[model samples]
Target: MATVFITGESGTGKELCALAIHDNSARATGPFIALNCGAIPQDLLESEVFGHVKGSFTGAISDKPGAATAADGGTLFLDEICEMAPALQTKLLRFLQTSTVQPVGATRPRKVNVRIVCATNQDPLDAVRRGAFREDLYYRLFVVPIHMPPLRDRGEDVIEIAQAALHRFSVEEGRNFAGLSGEVETLFRNHPWPGNVRQLLNVIRHVVVLNDGGLVTLPMLPESLPRSVQPPPAPAAAAPTDPASSGYVLDSLIGRPLAEIERIVIEATLARFDGSVPKAARALELSPSTLYRKIEGWRGA
Candidate 1:
């Protein structure tokens, strides 16, 4: 069986991908076990990964099968694999090399036939380079690498996923929800969701759980969300520069309409930045999407 390694940012569904792999593999009928290496204490990690015999230690009142033995015939997914201690890493490497596990305080080693799937949010190779992770163990688990894309880059899929979550959470909470409003849709599109799908799911659940929703609105969204979809503020008149060199006099801009002045300043900034919208937005102290939306509105007008 081949080992699969998954890499992505937090909440990008690394465990979900691992389950998909196991469900589609030849070991579909067998058991699938998962453990978060970073969530367990370092002292107890060995017993958790490999069973400890009775009377082995203070808490060893009974014999228990560890994750590797429990998933003997199927898949064992280890999330945040890089967080494993160095001693555990060496033992893990030995298990991968020989397909055998020796339980803690046990005299004999037992052979296990199971596929391994490991996932981490950090760069495994970089961890190896810094000596935070074992180089030999890295090679063993890095047989097949899969990288999950962040939600912001997935375009309309964000809305689709959010809508699905809305429907499901609404039913679970006994709320009648229609869908998102036009303004909320625009907000979702412009939002750079750093937490990916998990953030969107939580937002939807938050809306459903708190309010009896008909249609999700901008007010229903969390206060922490980025306000990039809102229109930029009107440009204010600044101190006069050399009118002859700048061409546009500050006094002239003062008497002009707000819309006209805003257009002139935005266009001038865009031109100054060589037609780069992001650079222009940075110079104007506005979000790139907000600047683009304003320019698009001006064009349509």
Candidate 2:
């Protein structure tokens, strides 16, 4: 395959896609090396990607082969390519053109037969236009561009993926997981999922780790999840028609638990608004997200 450029939001599995490409390529038996350009300090990046001789720099105590050399005869996956410094970009472009790498403090260049797979969360063309990335280098690596869509656009696929994650995490955590509750599934479907699959995986893992699981429930979900995503609460029992009537008992909920009363009131308010969550929330003097969480818990129960 040609030099592959993968672009997507942070949690869209760009690196995972790169790994799949490597695993299915002719170099499957060879090593699959990965480097996160953004994670490394700028000063040490060159040496890390191009190796260094023992006396190359202040911290170069011994001869070291860099990622490019390590990935020889295999696949080299570079993540956050846009974060690479300009100087490093030039060096990378040269290496791509000549199929050779010049290690730090080394006079000689070494040849490597490695497939280049790069990824970035930013749009490369936009970065190029902004001059944050080199245009020529962008074109060179954009040979086989693959864009992974965020999870929210995948519709029901979100639930499918989450269910799989739930099962896997349950097994890993040694819990008897049945599955997600219906309310949890609806929440998953409606959630914007800003963190994508990575966030979903963590959510599932959080649920599994925090409680002994029978089924994943809304209360088990993280507090950070948005409240607008939750479905409106179920309708409450009808109120008494007359306040002064002997049958109209004002003490009907006298012995009810505070939590139960809260649930009933919230549900009734939600029903009064014809299932309009925001309207119900405003009427109930609660934030929409708070209402969502409360309703999620009630429905899950």
* TM-score leader: 2
lDDT of 2 by residue, 1-301 (tens): 5999987778989889999999999999999999999999999999989999998889889999999999998999999999999999999999999999888999999988989999988767668889999999998998986767677656799999988888887788898888988988888887867788999988888888898978777778888876457533347753544657535444766788988878767766766777666678678765444565455455457
TM-score, structure 2 vs. true: 0.75
lDDT of 1 by residue, 1-301 (tens): 8899998778778999999999999999999999999999999999999889999999899998899999999999999999999999999999999999898999999999989999988767678888999998998898987776566546688889999999999889999999999888888877767688899999998899989979998888888886465433333343344658465566567788998888888877776666666677678876454565566566456
Cα lDDT for residue 153, model 1? 45
Candidate 1: RMSD to truth: 11.4
lDDT on C-alpha atoms for all candidate structures: 0.84, 0.83
Clashes found in each candidate (C-alpha, N, C closer than 3 A): 0, 1
Question: Which residue pairs in candidate 2 have backbone atoms (N, alpha carbon, C) closer than 3 angstroms, thus clashing?
Answer: 227-289
